[model samples]
Target: MSVVKGLLYPLPLLIGFACAPSALGAFLKDSKLNLNLRNFYINTDYREGHAGTSKAEEWGQGFRLLYESGYTDGKIGVGVDALGLLGVKLDSGKGRHQGSTTLTSDGDHAADQWSRFGATLKLKASKTDLRVGTLMPKLPVLVFTDTRPLPQTYQGGMVTLRELDDITLTAGKITQVTGVASADRTGMAVAGGRRQSNDFRFAGVDYRTRDNFLLQYYQAALEDYYSQQFLGVSHIWKVTEGRSLKSDLRYFRSRGIGANAAGEPGYQIAGYTPDHRGEIDNDTWSLAFTYAVGRHSFMLGYQSVSDDSDFVHLNQGSLSGDLGARGASTYLIAERLQSYFGRAGQDTQIAQYSYDFAAKGIPGLNVTVAHQDSEGIQSFAGSSLRERETDIILTYAVRSGPLRGLGLGLLYGELNSEVTPDQNQLRLMVSYNVELF
Candidate 1:
């Protein structure tokens, strides 16, 4: 593993220099570098129930450096991009440390610091581009999580083509991933499965019309686990000069494939399954509507999960043996700050309101509040359960002067559940970015 990691880390840099030696001037002239600093603090209190710990709190400072080189001038242009990430622990003790959310664990306490580096080699020809090495994809079929101090990263290769007007095509395959809290990379797996699969493939297409309409279809499969297909549509209508309404609809169908279908030992999924057999069979759908007028915006949505299994995604959280691989995100309406609300046979309703203070003379301030109620959940013990969550967020950014580009934010969330422990969480953050030539 160490040998493979070492070779992969410098492969992009080598390839870029070798392929674009003659166009070094253009690459150097168009290069860009940036540095971002972040200070994050989080506290979670378990209001009821008994697991082990009652509360978890942590504070950390993070640094991210990014560099991007311009593509060489030619029919097939070549470029390179690099990333460096570092996280330093500010406050965390044995009792206060949580499971690899913001910081990795060392013995019984949190690690003092952690860091990693990655690079990508890219080539472009006509309206198509190909990238290899580290990737952070944000698509309907697969999206990377960045909720913690450091963002999760994947090792893969992808190609994107925009040859047709108002249309896009994408395909990719990922072999490994490094979690946000850990610096080590591991094979890919789902939430409840202990086995790892190095082959995950996906392809998608997006088409847009002239009349504010978008249509999408995507297919993905994790080897020996499950296969999934997604369909989505979106539209926007202008009610007046300052008012608009938007509607979004999404659907997914998934079923067990190789090992999972055969009921293998380590390939079984977690959550509620029919007949107590851990097979992946699910159909999930959601619809949302948003109305915006002036500085205020309102949104409402509904989601439904099939009773056969929980909604599945590329989740490594259940791989307890892998350090820092305990966090993931899904493209679902129920993906809240504290709880995802993605359980078997669960149905969710969501409401949100946000206000931009610019209309009230505060140009860089904003506030948002959201609520979610979910019920009809089927637990593994053959019982029914329910859960709900409420979240509030406030943010301010300095738009000018010495403190320009500085941002401050606060978030609070509370969750009440019938099957799990009730909890409340608070988060504070400050961030700034610097541009370097």
Candidate 2:
């Protein structure tokens, strides 16, 4: 507590700056308009465990527009940002289906239509800012999931302060969620049920030193569900001439809170609650290391789960298990594959390898492979879940041609689990990014 208080001790001094009067044109930057264009194509294939269940493949094209308003010409700057997103199904229907999104119906075929718009507002003062409305947050406990045709967004208000050197403070309350696959925004709640909590709340602080060392502390609460705390650290070091190694360590602790735990007895009777105790407490930790040599990079990581269920995902939903799928995510605040971590008492081992074509005189080609294995899961007597996942990624981009920013990727994954369903996937993606000043 003392450490945290010391970090926030500068708030009063920074508040003074925000309240101080400013002369005309003294604190404002001219407003400007920026446009970015993206053309994206994706194809996915899914193979289901049961032959009777529908297997699927899907393809789509999407366009995203982002517009930002320059700060107001005032001491307390104000602005707005509008994001326009549209996804059009290029192929889909009954024999081969894709998703359960409202945008798609009973057919394996897609609706042949495009879905679209979300926006946000901002207010800034000194080194602090408040953002509200359509939001994509990439925080430790909550992350916007965007692994499909569209990007997921949330409805929330958040404040960030960077008034302290090498330190940042963040807090927020969220009310609803907008899924990546649909245009509708649903009331927010815990992932496994109809439970809803008063605006979800969170606060955290992180610091990164000049020496490439990072430290973080965070707490997040979901009304009637759970409250979680996360702490993490990372360091990057040069291991040899022209070679570097990076280490990342992370931990999360959680407990059932309010309604989720107290009322769990009733839910348990209905086969909803999976554990006892008004609290859902578990300890999760991981250590990852990466080393780079010329154009070849290799990473190895290990994680442990001390609970009976998988780690939490804010708005986790089922995937279609389609043909080609890519699970990569962007945005620092969004959830990572690391989020869906464990099923209590489970330990997982991960390995990954990648190569850049730059070493081979192929400017924009790269390849990667990753695998994970987990065990010690909860199951009927004499059985434990043994899941193995393998992923392959291939990417190519134009080097110095007219299509400088054009990029293409092929992703493939296969999952084999003991006493668990089987899942296989494949995905191909193409994208172009253009910047206009």
Candidate 3:
């Protein structure tokens, strides 16, 4: 069957079973339904040397409804999940809206409203669960980002096995994805590539030792593009009461395959490449240390990217061209608010400090400050460049009151770069959740 037909054919059957009297007992008893209301606003001001616009600003409200039905009572159970998303443009003055994935575009302006619906059919047996359709994977190889008012979604099937003690296994294949600001599903590709790949496959294993240590390994491939492997290790140590330290290390190796390796037209990545050939061959690594005591936490980290090519991941930004299909996340410590710091041959240093207000009688409140300095970025012309960024964020959530589920957040960030335009950004968000069960 075709991909579209396969994805659509199971919906009616699942819905029919959901409405049947025989499936109502256990299905309804353990089911959950939630509605989330989010108000978001963002503003970016270009400090110097911006070609297109001096500023980009937008405001929108999002409504998300999620429903998860309990599996039928049996050794092998079945269930269904559904998601509904809606976004309404509240403000985006003319000449201020950037065609980003945060909002859909209409002609030369932002769309007034946009919405989409998704469904998934799931099955469970013992310690293994399988889900087909509408995925938001959070694995090290791939992550569905939710930095905007609406979150991105993928069309695929994923299987998770947890039958062994202190071990987890995951495997999945993704065919298409709907961008955060788009209602249409599109194929996946890497940065600066215009061709799309429908076959993105991944598998991973995670093992946790009894002594509070975690080891991870994952392999992923974007068919006809690139293949990648990741290795990670993390551990924590306790020094005294309420004092602890954490150490995390991660590494990735990627290489071009198929069309990308053959240097075919429209299949090459856009970045500083070896000998000006746009092929993927890179190794990236990062190490971070964090210390926590009482209400204070401090972190320091360093990251380096190989000079052959930029770090590779599934990014659809350039594939969709001007349709606003952008925004992606990477499993790197240098992924900041304004920059990823993943440029070819780049090295980045990171530092952060955060405080929890619960120790001072203000529960559910926290603030964080972070900074990054990056240099040795290989430009297309074979010269090096540098950039820096700093971010401040504060958040508060009502702990116990009539408005207990309400949350408010504020963020401010600044970036100065030699390769791109200098800019400052600010974001404000308010969110509340309602239980519909």
Best by lDDT: 3
- Per-residue accuracy of model 3 over 295-363 as CA lDDT, tens digit each: 999999999999889999988888755555688998898788889899898899999999999988999
Report the error of model 1 at residue 409, Å. Answer: 1.4
lDDT (tens digit, per residue) of candidate 2 on 1-44: 34224333443343334333352133224423333333333333
Q: Return the TM-score for each candidate structure.
A: 0.95, 0.81, 0.96
What lDDT does each candidate get?
A: 0.87, 0.63, 0.88
- Candidate 2 vs 3: which has more lDDT: 3
Candidate 2 error regions (>4 Å): 1-48, 51-54, 101-109, 264-279, 316-341, 380-383
Candidate 3 deviant stretches above 4 angstroms: 1-13, 18-20
Q: In lDDT terms, how accurate is model 2?
A: 0.63
lDDT (C-alpha) at residue 148 in model 2: 61
